[model samples]
Target: MMEKHVQEFAFMKCLPALTLAAAMATVGTMIPVASQADTSPHSGPAQATASTQYPVPTFEGEWAIMAMDPVKVAGNRALGPAARLLVTLPDSLQKIVGQNHFSLSRQSGSAWQGKQDDLTVTFKLVSENSAELHISGKENHKLDLPLYRNN
Candidate 1:
């Protein structure tokens, strides 16, 4: 019938729009988001354990990592579970690392080490104004870098 043909034509006209709507819905779902809740014990952000308590409080201040050097500076300052380090990495090194926070601990004297996931950063105090930071990854060997401190 003519009425049936008209209905079919209307559906055909709306076919592209319906297809586009379906595609848009799928696109929204395609973007993956990182879950805040993690099931693994060590997979989430740093937790305040008795052992992870920072022993250097004297070095507590707004510390910024500038340059690429291994510097050692730690005193007795407790880094709580919510502590996070703002890191600015080189272009080549940014791909492997995610938005993970590094937890630092004093080794001995002026030596310190920070860890985030499988990455380890060693700090050696070069001077009161300057320091050194070396980054090492699980898959990669030793990668040393220098760091300068501001206040």
Candidate 2:
């Protein structure tokens, strides 16, 4: 009975320390949530997921293929025959690329391949700002185009 009393006394002595430790832990967890709330515009269910990160790098803006008028386009000849190709990834579709773009070809590593209606679209990222786009249209028309980010 005497030993039991001593043990209870020890626990009583440590109670305040244990309560402080639990409070500190709760505050530590809340700090990150508070900071994340301030930094991120979308929280809770709207937060971005792993799938949102899969869109081709530098492929989120407006891009136009080379034009015949070299002076207007600043003579970006790497465009080659793809001069007629125009690619646009509006902000709306960029967020759900997997459900939209990946439906056709699915995402190959570092690239996206898919078919929309009669056009077969393949996008390969060469760099952050440059990518190779291949489109095969109906009637055997094929365009192997290099794309550059415009915006």
Best candidate (score: TM-score): 1
Q: Total clashing residue pairs per candidate?
A: 24, 2
For residue 32, what is the lDDT in candidate 2? 67
- TM per candidate comes to 0.39, 0.37
> Stretches of candidate 1 above 4 Å error?
1-96
In model 2, which runs have C-alpha deviations exceeding 4 angstroms? 1-57, 68-106
RMSD, every candidate, angstroms? 17.8, 14.1
TM-score of 2: 0.37
Report the C-alpha lDDT of model 2 over 1-151, residue by residue, as the tens digit: 9999999999999999999999999988887653343445553233223244334323445444575211011112233232222234433433423222323233543455667677676766565556676667688877676666565
- In candidate 2, which residue pairs clash? 105-113, 105-114
**CA lDDT, every model vs. true structure:** 0.55, 0.51
After the best TM-score superposition of candidate 2, give how far the Cα of residue 82 lies from its true spot, in angstroms.
Answer: 29
Once all C-alphas are superposed, what RMSD does model 1 give against the true structure? 17.8
